[model samples]
Target: MIQPQQQSFNQKIEVSNNFGIEVYVKREDVLHNEISGNKFRKLKYNLLEAQKLGFVKLLTFGGAYSNHIAAVAAAGKEFGFETIGVIRGDELVDKYLENPTLKKASENGMQFEFVTRTQYRDKNNATFLNQLEEKFGDFYLIPEGGTNDLAVKGCKEILTDNDKMFDFICCAVGTGGTISGIINSSYEHQKVLGFPALKGDFLFQDIQKYAENGQWNLVTDYHFGGYAKINDELKQFMKQFFKKYLITLDPVYTSKLFFGVINLISKGYFKPNSKILIIHTGGLQGLQSNIAEI
Candidate 1:
């Protein structure tokens, strides 16, 4: 069984004093250069279980710039499994070089199957899965965004006894697996706040399926026009944030999480002397896709 490196918590200096609240970030991004952040946690046990089940190939779904896709490719290479990425957009097939995320995954030996967006939506349908099984021939399927019961089980290990001092736990929600695990492991008095990168209320229902506790809430106001969408304001914020704190946040997930946490602090949403812990769910590889634009 391949094990992910354990990470430690680091305090943000300037932001900690803002609004009289102390903020700390768990440096899950530094856990691994390729398979970093929540992706590593989500894939940790899934890979183990696949190996235990005597599976040699791993099949999963993701978008053009999905961090999960890149992480799975790297993990498969490291753990001796064949990887197949069912990409969302068919147009991306001929233009993989233009997208760094896809390029990296391809370089890591992951086979790609491009599908239309409408067809991709039926990824969980039985008929769709049956077709994939017939085509791929006996492979373990990991859902899009890597959210599953085993994934949530791995995520629960993110928080530990040392995290009990925090009043609130914050994380970026993609498929809700990471937050679900944090909510399950958090202290009773601690409130889990999820800043979603996508715009929609559907995540509430998705998360409710896995989270066992009622202490978590989704902050839906900071998506910045939805998934993989960004603007100059968000770009400038990330640039200055890195300059000040020396922490590079990806435009997809961690950026929105920090943006929401800071905005909530300025709005007096959190009480004074509150200790807030933010999960830095890394998607740094996605930064390469936006480097030219941002």
Candidate 2:
């Protein structure tokens, strides 16, 4: 098994004194250029288990510009496992070359199985699994966003003894695996806040399945429309944020998370001298899809 490296220690983000909060980000995005951020964390143990179980191929599901898909493809290539991406949107199959994320995954040797949106929603259905098994032969399946028990186990490692000082832990929520791990590992006094990139409260239930404690809450106001949805205001904020922090936040996750944290700070929601640690879950590849817009 190839062990993943630990993330860098606190990289402080400068904030105004009026906010009375100290913000620091754990640089999980730089953990690896390809398999970076929570994607790496979620996949770390999944890959090990797959290899141990004697699985030769790994199959997963994702959208057109999913960082999970790209990370899996890169990890599979590096670790010697055949990878298959059950991508949503059948139209993407013919336009892979035009889509940077899909093109990169293909370059890394990930086979594509483009399914319609309706079919993609059945990704977790038993019938879907049976069909995939018959079509692709014996393979280990990792769910979309890689949020199984093993994936959450890997994500729990994102925080360490050094992070216990923070009063609040923040992360962007997608399928909820990453924040669930954070919630499980956070200090007793730490309140973990999740900013969902999608516009919905359903993630609260999804997270409940894995979180071991009640020290977490979902801040659903900063999705900027919905999943993979963005606007001019969000683009401008991202540009200003990058210019100030020298850190690039992908529109899909980290951007929304940062935006939420800052908004909360501005509203004095957090008490004075509060220490906040934000998890930078990487989805940088999603930026390529919006290059023309931003």
Candidate 3:
């Protein structure tokens, strides 16, 4: 892990005087430009473990615009390890250079193997993994979203003693890793709320696999249609939020999360005087395409 010179801090968000709740955002985004937020937490120990195991190369999986792919590529470049991204969509094989995320990863010295979406769906299959092994030789395999036991272990370190004052901890969920880690580290007095970026019932079960306790709940109302899907209202909300807070929220995750939490506050979802802390798991690099639209 490349420790930042300055650590993440909690910054309070000013909401309407009508609501009696206090909301603060943990600026995990400031940790590192590329390895910011939960990606840093998720990959910290995974990279160390890979190096400890004497692996010279690392392989992971993600889509063309996945934050995990970008982070892994940057990490590999900085740490002197070869990175391989088994990208989804064989159609992108020739045109991946057009994609900001993939282009950035490639520039960081990461190699890519484009596969069909169907093949990506079955990426965990033993046969396919064996084929990758035959092709790329030995490498440390980090899962799609960089979620694993080590990743969870790294995530557990996100919370500090200063966070104990909050009554509720909130974060955007993707593949269940970040929330699970937060759930494990949460104090008994705090409730963990996850705003999933994608709509799916499988998340609960996946979260259950790693969460050490049951104090977490998924807020399914704010996915904004589904993963990577955006709308005019959400775009406006994000724009207004940045204008008001001077903080940029990525359209894919943090924007929806902040929108949900604030909307819920307006609806009286949180108890009066409750303290809320929202985890800002950064993926601002993925916002490159949405910036022009916003």
Candidate No. with top TM-score? 3
**lDDT for each residue of candidate 1 in 13-59, tens digit (9 for 90 to 100):** 55744567888888888888898888899998999899899999999
For model 3, how does the per-residue alpha-carbon lDDT over 1-294 read when each residue is reduced to its tens digit?
Answer: 456535899999988846588999999998888776888899999999998999999999998888999999999988889999999999999999999999999999999999998998888999999999999999999999999999999889889999999999999998889999999999999999999988888899999999998488999999888888999999899899999999999989899999999999999999999999999988998788762110
In candidate 3, stretches whose alpha carbon ends up further than 4 angstroms from where it belongs are 291-294
Reference-based TM-score of each model: 0.95, 0.96, 0.97
Task: List the candidate numbers ranked by lDDT, top first.
Answer: 3, 2, 1
| Candidate 1 lDDT | 0.88
Q: Cα lDDT for residue 201, model 3? A: 81
Root-mean-square deviation per candidate: 2.2, 2.2, 2.1
Clashes of 2: 0
* Candidate 3 local lDDT, residue 227: 86
